[model samples]
Target: MSSNSNSNSGRRRPALLVLDLINEIVHPDGKYAADGYFAQARDRSVLERTAEAIARARAADIPVIYVVVGFSADYTEWPAGSPVFEKARADGRLKLGTWATQVHDALAPEPGEPVVAKHRISPFHGTNLELLLRTREIDTLLLTGVSTELVVLTTAQAGHDLDFRVQVLEDATLAGDAEIHAAALKVLSRIATVTTVEGALPSTG
Candidate 1:
């Protein structure tokens, strides 16, 4: 799918949002790896594509904001009735300050980059993501992450509702399987610009 050109006259200020690429979610040894996320990521080379996107954003002087999902050791932030986080709570995974919650090394944030910790699917829900974007005058969001049907889709919708131009880097995201990933991208195309890392960034040449 291709992105529509920006209609606004002013230049668009953009930021790259790397969401839930943490070890517990995307890494091969992650808690959810057995469920097929790792396999899909490996086949798609999601990490490599996302790393390229991050590098492009940095070279273009665009901000790169990292969003990670995790909760306190006591699991207080977790939703008791939510099936999405039930496994995490039961297995005691995704606790803050743990390696499972850290961003994968391949696409790890630079020292001064902003890493926003979230407890829910949508990063903007209880996090300062909006504030950070507003402070930086970023009017566009380039999204890349794991679980295409979950975090990527949710964030795209939320970003659209918040009046930001949202673009999903399809190659940089993974899901349970190829079909699931394609379906999520189809849905996301309705509300966001579904594109590749190369399409989202400028050419280095």
Candidate 2:
């Protein structure tokens, strides 16, 4: 079905799901910089593109929702033996209330925009994301954020399985490596409509 299509009926209630584009992962001095993911995000100008996407979505009256990843100060929510989050807990990154956990300044959420904090890569895991979407009646999601191979890929598939119309904004997401980004996009195209920021927006002309 088209991104604007709803599961129960042919109605469109679209929203933008901005995932994990926080300082803890996207900035040059982020705690995960040593992992080399931030470098790729910067090179790809993910923040700039995401900023543009937010602007376009807002202009089109689309709900803009941010999904941020952070942990309790005591690291209580850090899942045990999880490869994706083990290093973060060990290195003390993504501490709540820290500057590193804030969304990238370029794409800071405006007033009234919902910011969903999640502990896992998938925004829906252990979070109220589904509830929020259901409340807003949003069934079509425009997914954007860092590490296309992980969060973006996972969320796209999950969103599809959940009966939501999903679309991945190519220019607005970043990955650890160019090859990985390309491969994820290729795979995601099968489950979701992969488009650039401009293409994802409704035509003003």
Prediction 2 global C-alpha lDDT = 0.87
Q: Residue 11: error of model 2 in Å?
A: 4.4
lDDT of 2 by residue, 1-205 (tens): 3343564465667899899888888888888877777888778887788888899889989999998998999999988889888887777889878998899888999999999999988899989998898888888889899889999999998899888889999999888889989999999999999998888885575
**TM-score per candidate, in order?**
0.95, 0.93
TM-score of 1: 0.95
lDDT of 2 at 138: 83
Stretches of model 1 off by over 4 angstroms after superposition: 1-9
Summarize candidate 1's per-residue lDDT along 1-205 as a digit string, tens digits: 1123344535788999999999987888899888898888888899999999999999999999999999999998999888888898888999988999999999988989999999999999899999999888788999999889999999999888878899999999989899999999999999999899999996787
Error of 2 at 165 (Å): 0.5
